[model samples]
Target chain A: MEKTIIVNAKSKTYNIEIIDHGLKKLREKVQTVWSPRKVAVITDENVGPLYANQVQRQLNAGGFVVEVLTVPAGESSKSWMNLEKIIQQLAEKHFGRQDGILALGGGVVGDLAGLAASIYLRGIALIQLPTSLLAQVDSSVGGKTAIDLAAGKNLVGTFYQPDLVLIDPTVLLTLKSRCLVEGYGEIVKCAALVGGDFWQLTGQIKSPQAIMRNANALIEASVRFKAQIVAADETETRRRQLLNLGHTLGHAVEQAAGGRLFHGEAVAIGLYQLSRLFEQKKLTAVGVTEQISTRLQAVGLPLSDDELGTTDFYRALKHDKKIKQQQLTMIYLKKIGQPEFYCYPIKQVIGWLQQELSQKKS
Target chain B: MEKTIIVNAKSKTYNIEIIDHGLKKLREKVQTVWSPRKVAVITDENVGPLYANQVQRQLNAGGFVVEVLTVPAGESSKSWMNLEKIIQQLAEKHFGRQDGILALGGGVVGDLAGLAASIYLRGIALIQLPTSLLAQVDSSVGGKTAIDLAAGKNLVGTFYQPDLVLIDPTVLLTLKSRCLVEGYGEIVKCAALVGGDFWQLTGQIKSPQAIMRNANALIEASVRFKAQIVAADETETRRRQLLNLGHTLGHAVEQAAGGRLFHGEAVAIGLYQLSRLFEQKKLTAVGVTEQISTRLQAVGLPLSDDELGTTDFYRALKHDKKIKQQQLTMIYLKKIGQPEFYCYPIKQVIGWLQQELSQKKS
Candidate 1:
């Protein structure tokens, strides 16, 4: 099924083909979609060492001056210094009017590279080749490219639409265990949102090997779930807020952990918390919290909030960019394949956190 | 006079209106153009001290929350660190999607504030109230906003277009002598490029006071000339390149002087150098260079390359952003109101620079 996510807000927005083996029509893709002379492919050390040459060769073969710029892998590299260097290089290389860039790595590379593509020459044609599971499933399609500042993650960035996204399902085979589990958290979020079809498919993905090895089923199910959410609200204005089911607390968990917690592991804990809160509100039935915890743990994710040290959890939550109008908007899982967004006023949310702290002390 | 400057490559663009007593329509002018909740007016110490309060009052009277964000006046503030701080402040202040920003200072404020507007809440509405003469004519109109880095100026920035440009001619009344002359360089460049009825006006204006004293004549002439050139070619692919007449060497002059050389002064010298070169090419004969040089000199401008030290001339020229295919393209003057772009091969341009240097040494 080819469903296109139309970001109708911008002047130039193209269709996003949500299907497996999307990278097969590489040359035709470029000709049909973009009209760029030069393409700077920014990747990470890990992905660059593996697939940089192949991607570069393909782009070069498709008639582009493909320049491979690689940085070391990790969340830390998404810095101002790195962004400035890439901008200078882009200008020095004369990546101008007809020229653009291809972001070829996981989330950090996709983010920083996309940001570079966004600002350089003021919005160039961008193509995403997301190597990591995290990027391919979530970050790549969202049109959100940002670099982190010292204060927190993604403090400095912009929302720039990419010309095309190239997802090679074959690349997921190289992901580590931690990466695989984190990727599945988003996959599970998809399952939880899209209903019986996605939930049944995710339940069938019991074995870690089955989930990791299976590309076609994963891509189809995951892309469909994501395509629906993105199609409805591309800018995250209304209905799109529900897609952040576990991310509110999960993002804070990652921050508190100081980049220690893999995004999926943190999300699992967020799902657990959200489910419990939903149960308290009668939005979810009894045992939903346990189901979420069990499912997440089975998928090799930590479902407990024990990892988030009590002291910095509240501090981290304050910096959450998603909070607008002094409300700590939380998305909760009402049931499997069901999510709901409810604005918990900041005072109440902070009070709940304090209650949790008191219970721990007692 | 009613011509529109179509920003060739980009999606969004608005008109550059240069009218007398623009302050009267300040409310209607901004509201009609951009209906933002909050206008994040980034001013500097100098401009803010003078006009920030008045602008704030005007916007407030129009029922808008005008937050005045002030930074120290200079080029040094245009940095990633400052950008980070501004983003943090905007986020912390709860500047939402409905909110936009008003850039109320000169180039530095416009660049920094416009860049902020481009990124904040994934880009919001931007309005320019450029105070400096350089900013009033140039930066306010073009959507090219950037911050400088150690490597170069405007190294990391975006082409974020503004919704409206509020060029209050009254602001020019308070401008220092040196800065006012700097603005004239842009006017002269605009005059030289679109030489027809307005072309004849350039040679006639004997004093800087001619521009400073009269609002209607100066605004009408400057706006028409620039707007036409911009209308012909917005993104500087061909026709717009003529606007950069003296900038090739002018930017180097500013960098060498450590921000001492006002932008207009550099252009004045750059124009002189270019006019002399045109004379050598038999492009502009009959004492065109002398005529233009004397007027600019009378208005307190450095009109000759002979005065500027020879050191770092080659190095500065190399770093120019307009270089293409290893050639240094220059926008030269053929007459008082006409500019011609010559994509001189780098070797020849360097040869010319050495000749100029030797001539100056003698």
Candidate 2:
């Protein structure tokens, strides 16, 4: 199956192609966009041994010189230390503006390699080959590349779009059960925004095995929803803010949990919290909360903040980079299909969250 | 007097304003664009003692929480070590996304601080107040912020445009004589590209004092020329490459010289070499070489490569990042008014340069 999403960014227009087992045509598909003499395939330790050589060999056989750069696996790899190391490797290998970088792993590899490509020789061609369902559906298509900082997550980054995004869902079959489950939160969030066929499609997914079986359809629906939002606003100014639906509280929850909760789990809890807040304010209908909560539970995602530290979560929220001029702008759904951004004083939101946390504890 | 040139980049549109004493209204003008809570005024050691306090006080009086970040003077300050230090300072001060950075020095300070701002909290507001003639005319106008690498200069950077550029030509009077003279090479290159009035205007300049005396007109012309090219092509893909009329060979020359030759001086040498090459190729008129040589001599710029190692220059050229697939794309003077880009094999250019150097020695 093939789907090409036309992301009409102001710099240039590119596509995101969703294909099954597309590694065979890696060179042919890449050649359609650029004729780079040399290409660097960047992956992480976990994904490198499995797929890096195969991808590099395929490109080499197609008459292009190819090399592989592998970083350690996981989120810690997204750091300035690793960024500098990767840049040194690219420099030592003499990757120039005419060359390209193939980000061939999960979100960590994709982000770090994409950022490296964005700065190498002031900018070069980047082709993303996202392996995980999370990467294929969310991170790869948006063009937001970043590395974690001592200050916060994604504190240092640039909005650099890729020349092309290749999503091969077949790779998800090899992902850990936890990884597969974590990806559903984002897919469900995307479904909430898209609201129609995708919602029905996500609703049909009952377990982790179902996610693997329906990975193609789920990935397509999620990416299509995000692509439309990104096409409208490449940089998150107003319209694109809706995509951050559960992210504000989600980030706080994740930070508070400190590696215990997966990103999607935190986001699932964030979505549940936001729905309740909206219903309390009468901004959303009463059962909008129950509807979203039910969907989250159906997917086996965490629906309540039972284990999270309330104070730590609130503290994390305070340092969030998105907080502007003492006010926090949050995205919440009015109903299933409609999403809106609302601004409230930081103190007000903290008070609300504090009350909710205490009430739940009692 | 003030002139505002609009730079329509893909990210957003910003204005480059050339003013007699732009620093006076720095706070008021900055407030017009953003209501940043706290602002960091970054400068070099040379410029900080002179203007950091003044700029910070002005902003403070205008109700902004202002602080200063001063790095050591000169090009060495544009290093990864300093970048890490600057980022650490920003984090320590709790500079959040709603804050801004004011780059208050020459090219080095502007480039470093601009880059810092581009990555802080994923990106924050940046207002450039160029305090040197070279910065006012060249670096400050284009939003190309970068830091140097061990491999080469500007091997790592991003196309992050500033929110505003404020040029204060009066500050040039306080610059070192050598610094003041170095600024002219870029001015003359801009004059050559603009032709007609600017060319005639450049020919009338007799000395460093004359450049300082006519600083307003000279700075405006140079900035306008660059702004036009940058506006047409925000990323140096096509039309914008013309602005690099002398930079290909210039970078190699600069690299070979280490810290001995300034950027503009190397550019002057590159311009002279390119004119002679064009003349020999019959691409330019017969006396075009002499005309450019005469103009360069009149401005007290170098007319020939002296004290410059020919072998080292060729080796540096070989390692240049701009060389694409073994071919170097160079911009040369087709005539006084016209500039063109052409691709030549590296070996062919090295052979041509070698022959020319040998013939000159004899």
Candidate 3:
């Protein structure tokens, strides 16, 4: 059975339907929402061949004019060059503001395509069909669409909400084990923030198969927290910072690793590292670190990092957009289910990270 | 004397200050509003040398760290490449979410810089210091930040309002006659939209001197209408679209001219051509054509187009983001003040244009 979650953003309200084989009923689902004269299913090079044809056929069968546009798959495709090309093709196809773009791929493709939809004729309707576990859980729900610059990931973007997000756990059957585990990093973050029952549930999952078995329930809980956080602070001003609990160090480590570390793996290490900081501050109860580590390791996420040492971490933090007036905003766990924010001077943060790194090594 | 007009857009309300020698008091003005720790004055090659140094010095003297970054001047600078460079520089400077970007040039600079501000760290504060007449009167007040794509102009953009818009008409003293006239085209469109006193005022103006002498009143009136329209819609869904009066054909003609015709000049011609269509349909009163013609010609705005013939016009329309499912959404004048929207299929629009083109030639 399919479950639907409604994200009530200020500007627009959209539905996120979590299901099995949702792609097969793509036409019926779209038709139930709104009918457009034309539809463009924008996918990536990898996912396009896998699902683009099926998506196009369904929409076409529903008597809607459908065209599938594909960009090269991977993080690199989320560049302005690809954005330009996709925009050029959309123009050539004579797609108007009233038409729709179905973003059919992973996070990178969804981001690029959703951004194109946001800015195409000021703003248009966008339906995100997130195929990857990472996208299905995280990027797809928020109206935050962006393209990367050389300086940072998601350097250029807008808070443009999508009209719909269709998530199918069955699609995860095709995702690599690494990709699945990477998604769990975000899941763990959500579980920790939610605490209580969700935290208990997260502690039980041990492997990729266990994650798949519980994907529907976990996604619903995670998406509920994300949707609520997004609805409250769609622009990432205050409450939403909780979602970035591990992302502060995670982003730096991921960038420093230069492609060796997956985002979730880096985030896993970030969680472990920050847990130690929490322990020092007495923010979390005793043994919180062990519980987080146990949960992460059970899902095959890394608890230690050999790469991206302290110096690299400091350098990355200096360039982070979150740092204002030499002050960095860091999110920490008050407990497994409760997160809190702290703003520290760069000097103090550097010292803290140095201490953490040296202690870890010893 | 200085005047402040409040633009009450739904998402945010901002002030547009029209003053003489406004740039001289830049520091004082910014200090009154918010004291950003760092200020990045983003300008263009042409305007940067003229004002970037002075702006930076003033802000620096006010005890705020200041940096000036210049992009190559003109419409070409509104490319993805320049956007990437600007983002990189801001990130490298460690400019954070609480910082401010002072957009200190013409429409191109304001657009690119404003867009960069809107997405940097989700968003940063933007203060527009529009230099050109077009920028001051039109692009500055509307919160519409965009970059041109090869497909069409403003194909990628956002409805991100600025925190402040500072208009210094004295800066127009350095602008050329063509630039001055281009601005009048928009002024004419605004005057036509807002009938009565504004229309009479527009009809009275004849020369560049008159425009400069009456700049404050004219800008206030034009900006007032724009602000009201934006307040009601914010996004170009319904009422806001009326602002596109004369822009449909105007954009096509501008592109077809290949830099030969200025944007406002092409818009002036578009106003003229569409008036002719309205007259034929008897949708306009008998003297409407003569009044619009007299006003456009009196202001030295172009009333005829030689660069863009009918064939090129149709081709350009085919690629416009405004066209959906082969239908073109055109904004027309019901009378002097009232405007209406109509969507015409490509076939009908082509025939109408062909007839109008031959009629003009004959």
Candidate 4:
């Protein structure tokens, strides 16, 4: 389904387009809107060296300065120090006012660099070019850009919107198998939540390798699912918060692991734990956990991970950014294709984690 | 002329009232919108010992947790290391999202604490209680919050808007004579660029000592003038940039001077130099230079100070955050009250500065 959602914000109406080859008309569409004099492309070292030259050439041909800024790959680059360095480099290169920043990497780059553009002299133009499946479907579609602190992941960020999102399916062919499988977890969540023909395709995803090898169809479906959600709730005021389904524990696990695990990998383990808990509490159907587990297994993500956290898992939960008023709020799958956030108070989570971790010792 | 302009932002609107007793109504108006549970009042050694008790008592009686967070007063306190300490303090105090941070000192506190608030779990809330006249008129109104880096001043910052501004004119009476006079320089620039009655009022300032003793009327005038400019152009798009009249040279001078000279003092000299440059170039009236000198003299700001950074002035210009495209864009006053920015090619300013410094040495 190629659905379009229009977001109206402060004399600007940006369209969230979800379809294969969405990058085709982007040059024409953006040329009419943005000033093409100076476009600073921010990507990670992994992605930058791969696609920087091609993107720069195209943008330069379009009459843009097209300065390529490469940060080291992974989450560690999204820090105040990195932001300072980027700002200094941008200022040196004269990227300001009329200029725009093209975020051309994964979630970390998009979030941090997008935030940098947002507050650069109080909001510069942002053009998102997501190269990963996770970024294409989730990170790139939404305008929530920021960096992490020692306190937690994405604890410091902004609700900054990008001018346009450029997602090329061609970019997915170059991704790692683990990255593809991790992205597929979100695809499964989205299909289950949105629950339309999108679910049918995801439910029929029998082999993870097969879907990863031919991801154009999966990419299109997943992008539409995310686009519709973000378009309705651009600021994450109400509806968008639900999309954080497995993210609460997932983010904490990732943060605690200190970048050892991928976001999607953590989320898969988090989803499994939450599903089992939901079934135990009678919050979910008897067969729901099995159905989700089967789908996740097909996508090459395990139903259980013994090496997730330590005896201090409960302590790590305290560091989650979603936490407020000592209540552990988490997004859980209500059914195979439905999700919602339920507030599991901190005291109860600590008690549950203590019991679960203690059981391991026995 | 007393004018009240509505600050138009998506969040909320507040009146920028150019009148005495603006502080009294300000509290009531802000309370009507977003009432703070507690007012964590962060002040400096000088400003805190004086007005912190009074403000605390008022807010306490008004039913808000009025804890005072005081620090040593100066630009050195604006550093990242100092900001980290303040953040630690804020965390230990367990200042929740419902509570707001109030900057009761000058620009240093406003910038440092405001940056802390901006990034403390991705922004809480901000209230400006600017004591120094410079902060009261400039940083207080705008959302340009930041902390200084070891590299340069205001190297790390965000454009975070304050929920309320509480400006008590009575507090101005207690300000140091030199400090008060330095602030008057900003008002002089405001008057010169804004023109009309503001310009005429500039002539009325007899001495820095007198200005300090009686600055309520002038403070309101200065604040209201700039407030109107910012209200229309909140993020410094077009007209708001006009407020930076003489800031190019002023910022360089201030940065070079480090903490020895206050912002307003450098601005005073910058304004004087700008006026003189215009007069010399046959761009203005014969007595324009004399008028600027007289106004600054009356305000008790040392326009041609021997203590200023005559040595490291050019070096400071290299760090101007606003510098883009290798051009040093400066805001200069055309007439007594209308200021304009002239983006000079960097080489021109560098050559001229070198020649001027050599002449000064001779």
Highest lDDT among the candidates is held by which one?
Answer: 3
lDDT of 3: 0.84
Cα lDDT tens digits for candidate 4, A255-283: 56666678888787777777777777788
lDDT per residue as tens, model 3, A1-362:
69989898877888999979999988888887757568888888789888988998999888878888888878888887888788878877767788888999988988998888887777778889999888888889888888887777887778888877889889888888899989888888888888998999998898888998898888888998899988888888889888898888888888777778877788888888788777987877789899999888897898877664556666776777777677889888887777888899978887877876787788
Chain B TM-score, candidate 1? 0.91
lDDT string, candidate 1, A1-362, tens digits: 34444444343455555445555556666667765377888988888988778776777788878888888899988987788778778867766555778887889998999898887756667888787777877888767888886667776678777877767776677788778778888877767777686667776666567776665566666765665666666667788787788888788887888877887777777777767766876888787677666667776777765545376877878767676556777877666666666887776887876776466556
Query: Global lDDT of each model?
Result: 0.73, 0.83, 0.84, 0.72
Q: What's the distance in Å from true for residue A304, model 2?
A: 3.4
Interface RMSD per candidate = 3.4, 1.4, 2.1, 3.9
Q: Write the per-residue lDDT of candidate 2 for residues B312-349, one digit (tens) a residue.
A: 78878887776888988887777788887789998898
Clashing pairs in 4: A111-A146, A192-A337, B192-B336, B192-B337, B193-B337, B193-B338, B246-B331
Candidate 1 at A33: error in angstroms? 8.4
Please report the candidate that would top DockQ against the real structure.
Answer: 2
Candidate structures ordered by lDDT, highest first? 3, 2, 1, 4
Cα lDDT tens digits for candidate 2, A1-362? 87777888755689888888887778778888878578888999999988988898888877778888888999999998988988888888888888889999988888898888887777888999999878988888888888887667777777788889988888888899888888888888888877888877877787788888988888888887788888888778778888888999899988888778988888898888888878888897778778777777876889766554367788889987778888899988877788888999999888887777777678
Best by TM-score: 2
Q: How many collisions between residues are there in candidate 3?
A: 0
| Pick by DockQ: 1 or 4, better one | 1
